[model samples]
Target chain A: MSMTMTAIVLGMTVVTYIPRMLPFVLLKGKELPSFWQSILQNVPYATLGALIFPSILTFHEDPSFALIGAAAAFLIAFTGANIIITVLGSIGILTVLSLFL
Target chain B: METTAAAQSEFKDGLAAGTGIAIGYVPAAITYGLLAKSAGLTFIETMSLSIFVFAGAAQYIALSLITIGTGIFEIVLTTFILNIRHFLMSAALSEKTEEEPIWKKAAYSFGVTDETFSVAAMKSGSIHSSFMAGLILISYSSWVLGSGLGYVAGNAMPPVVQESMGIALYAMFIGLLVPSLKTSLKAVLLAATAAILNCIFTYSGALSSGWAIIISTLIASISVEMAGRAREKGGIE
Candidate 1:
């Protein structure tokens, strides 16, 4: 890695660590208010949702291919397949579709 | 209170439990490694990212940011929002663990990824730092090693195959989101709100991609919560 990339890595490490460590350190003996806890619980789902939508559409040569992959992924995951299957299933579907496209 | 012997035993059990998660991480981590390599990250940079950052979504965003030549400020801010949920996970896990040295707590907190959090949270009874250490060690090592392996594998693949691998990241994201959407209407709305807001921001040239993501996430989360609260106040089911 170059000096700039290394710096970026270090910067990310700091930002990532602070959140992971801060609550464990600060809230060691206490509980968050229920509302805050609820919000926190919702954070992952909301964040993941935002990150995936729209962006996934632009990921392949044809938007349709990305959509097919997304559909495969959503179906596997929604059916409660493990993460491995959910991911590989999407890739598998996309690969097959790519042949025809 | 945990004796040294008991801590040792629990640590063994923790490793055993973590084996399940470690197995689960292999494909996901390898995919991350492959994608990182395809994004033009070096082996060391890719492996170090898994080692240091350890958050999947944040790392993915980092790759996207780097590929787009985003500013450092934007990269840092975008990752901060993506991983801030770890605060809740760590705080919740802390309640489940017995009091240990602040240093120990600090060390284990670094291992608190979304998957590990689910495992630790699902564990019954008070948690032991030694057990946490074992669990974290296995999962962390699996991720770092997997990244290295994936980078090597990506290097061996044909260019056409590698290019198609771009879909892997999007597929990974969809895989993550859909499971939760199955269980919650609130999740569907929050994600839709963020996606729409992000599109508007990006298309209007009002904000860079990083700020667009951060703003959309915050607004979506807050608005969804407020709407839920309003429904509660109005006695709507």
Candidate 2:
């Protein structure tokens, strides 16, 4: 890899690490408010939704393809399909759509 | 007296969880090692990134941006923004695990990942240090191993194939959303809201894709919280 690429990658490693590590360090043994506790409980769902939502809608040539695949994956998962199947099914459907479109 | 025993137990549980996560990580890390090498990253560079960044999505984003000749400043800014969710995750986990020593907390924090957070949160009882440590260790090992493997396998695959591998993270995210949807209507609403907001933002051209996520999340989360509160007040199920 180029020197610049290497540096960028390394730099990113540092930035990402700090954020992940800070709370464990700073908040250790510190009591947090109940409101903060409630908020924390809800944050993961919100954050994950935020992270995954855009991709499901926008990752394909026809946004509908992604939407359909996501819906299928969601249904399958909701119905208790194994995780591997859910992901593979979505990918398979998208790939097929890609081939056709 | 009981508290100390509980603390010890929590630490042990954390270690066990970390080990379990690490077992799965071995293959994935190998894949990552191959990817990095093909992307023109050297062994040491890839290792450093795996050791430090440890975030799959952000690292992949950084890699893509670098390959496309995005400026360093832009890349860094985008990554920082994309990873803002960690603040929320960490803050949440911290609340649950406020009994550990500072150094131990810091070490465990370093190992936080999406999988670790999920595993830890899903545990049935009060959060303990060992369980948290177990979860983190498993995830941390998987990540390091995956990156190492990706670097080694990097040269063997075509760029197209490597790019396709990028979907694994998205696939995992989908897996996460699906299971949760079965248990809670709130989760479904939050997810659907996020999707709608994401589509709106993408189409509006008002916000960049990265920022769009942050914006949509905030809006959707607030809406869900409000709607939930209203339901509770009305004595509705």
Alpha carbon lDDT of each predicted model:
0.74, 0.66
Predicted structure 1: lDDT: 0.74
Candidate 1 has an fnat equal to 0.63
Superposed Cα deviation of residue B2, candidate 1 (Å)? 8.7
> TM-score, each model?
0.67, 0.72
Q: Give the alpha carbon lDDT tens digit for every residue of B36-83 in model 2.
A: 676676688778777877876677777677667888778877777766
* Ten contiguous residues with the weakest lDDT in model 1 chain B: B154-163
For B76-180, candidate 1 gives per-residue lDDT tens digits of: 888887677677567667767797778888988899876666556645587888888888888888888877888887355554454455555555556556665
Per-residue lDDT value at B79 in model 2: 76
Off by over 4 Å in 1: A1-12, B1-50, B54-105, B112-143, B146-153, B158-173, B205-211
lDDT of each residue in A1-101, candidate 1, tens digit only: 78868888998999899988997788776777877666655555555655665666775567877777777877877788755576567666766666776
Residue B193 in model 1: lDDT: 87
Candidate of highest lDDT: 1
Interface RMSDs of the predictions, in order, are: 4.4, 3.8
List the pairs of residues colliding in candidate 1. none
TM-score of 2: 0.72
- RMSD per candidate (Å) reads 5.5, 5.2
